[model samples]
Target: MNEIPLEHVHVAPDDGVEDDPAPAVFVLHGRGADEEDLLPVAAELPDDHHVISLRAPDRLQDGYTWYELDLSAGGLESSQPDADDFRRSLDLIVGSVEAAVDAHGLDADRIGLLGFSQGAITSLSLLLEDPDRYAWVVALHGYLAESHADLDPDGIGGKPVFVGAGAGDRVIPQSRTEAAIDHLEALDADVTSGSFPGGHGIGPQELDAVVEFVASRTA
Candidate 1:
């Protein structure tokens, strides 16, 4: 079957938080999740940063997925190796982000990326591809495919990056998560790694840590 074109859109915050010129945090949801699925996490954020959640565009059943999958024994996707496609999606996201920054008079240097599952893969790739585009990256419960290892991300442009995973995850193992951390560290990226006690999902502990990590960097 021919591949469908990808699309993405922004989800502003709930709770009526006024958009400000301070800074923005882009939120990416996991596979089978919509743009608003993870809004609660963004809304729970302690800081008053502008929260932007983007849809992955590819529909799978009722939810959405960023890329195709090969749901076998392990949680790995079939490697299409579509580097160009990935670049285009990243470009689109960055373009919209630029417009948002301009409209709100935000400091572009303070923009950050946050994602979960499939969204985590995209978020990490964005920082690796363009380190200066974000002030930091927060990846939660995601794995990096072998194809991503070939790209040199220039070490996060001296920005901080935090990776969190569940030690008892069913889909993602601890080793894969650790290897991702090693890869980022090898690139001279400032990285912090942590593990929670759950399985393939974000718990309160993970959220608390993520909130603290983001707040410290933005402060």
Candidate 2:
């Protein structure tokens, strides 16, 4: 299938090596946010790797969305993703990442993923769909997509993953994040997780941890 070209902002490495392909981190923003939303967070990451912040394909409210949510199950906490839309977004992301690698001379094997909310769900799904394709992942304020529960991908063992959630996150309850952690641990993934005291958003402490986690892995 052809890749739907995603709009993005590419930040070149501060100290990139001329001949060596630079490692990369792909940033995905939460629902209703744009590619520019996480540029500040990207700025805090290690300066030796390339950072690409992508815009979601579907426009939503004044921003964008990776996929629509099905809230009939209850509310945000119990909501599920529209399965077909989720799968389509996943494929598009895969294609976009591949294209980015080629277009920017990236080190594909050293790729990382950092996402928030709905974007976080997509990042985790991508990791599960093909573990070897990513070097590390940071998922914040999001739960695992139910559609990927049946997948049992190989090579996920020992992959680095960081899951963060808000203790008071009504949108995606703490239990959901814990479940994702448990699943990753069961698969032998190198998991590091934490919870902040706020609601459905990243706190200062959470941001610090995320920065540290990504730096350690990328460095």
Give the number of the best model, judged by lDDT. 2
lDDT over C-alpha atoms for residue 167 of model 2: 95
lDDT of the candidates, in the order given: 0.74, 0.90
Local accuracy of candidate 2 as per-residue lDDT tens digits, 50-78: 89999999999999999898888887779
Steric clashes per prediction: 1, 0
Error of 1 at 56 (Å): 1.2
Best by TM-score: 2
Error of 1 at 214 (Å): 0.8
lDDT (10s digit) by residue, model 1, range 1-219: 222233344444345556555677888888789888887888766455777777776678889767765445443523332455556666666776776776556678788888987778778877877888888999998766565777775545456999998989876677777878888887778888899989988899999998888878876
lDDT of 2 at 5: 81
What C-alpha RMSD separates each model from the true structure?
5.0, 1.9
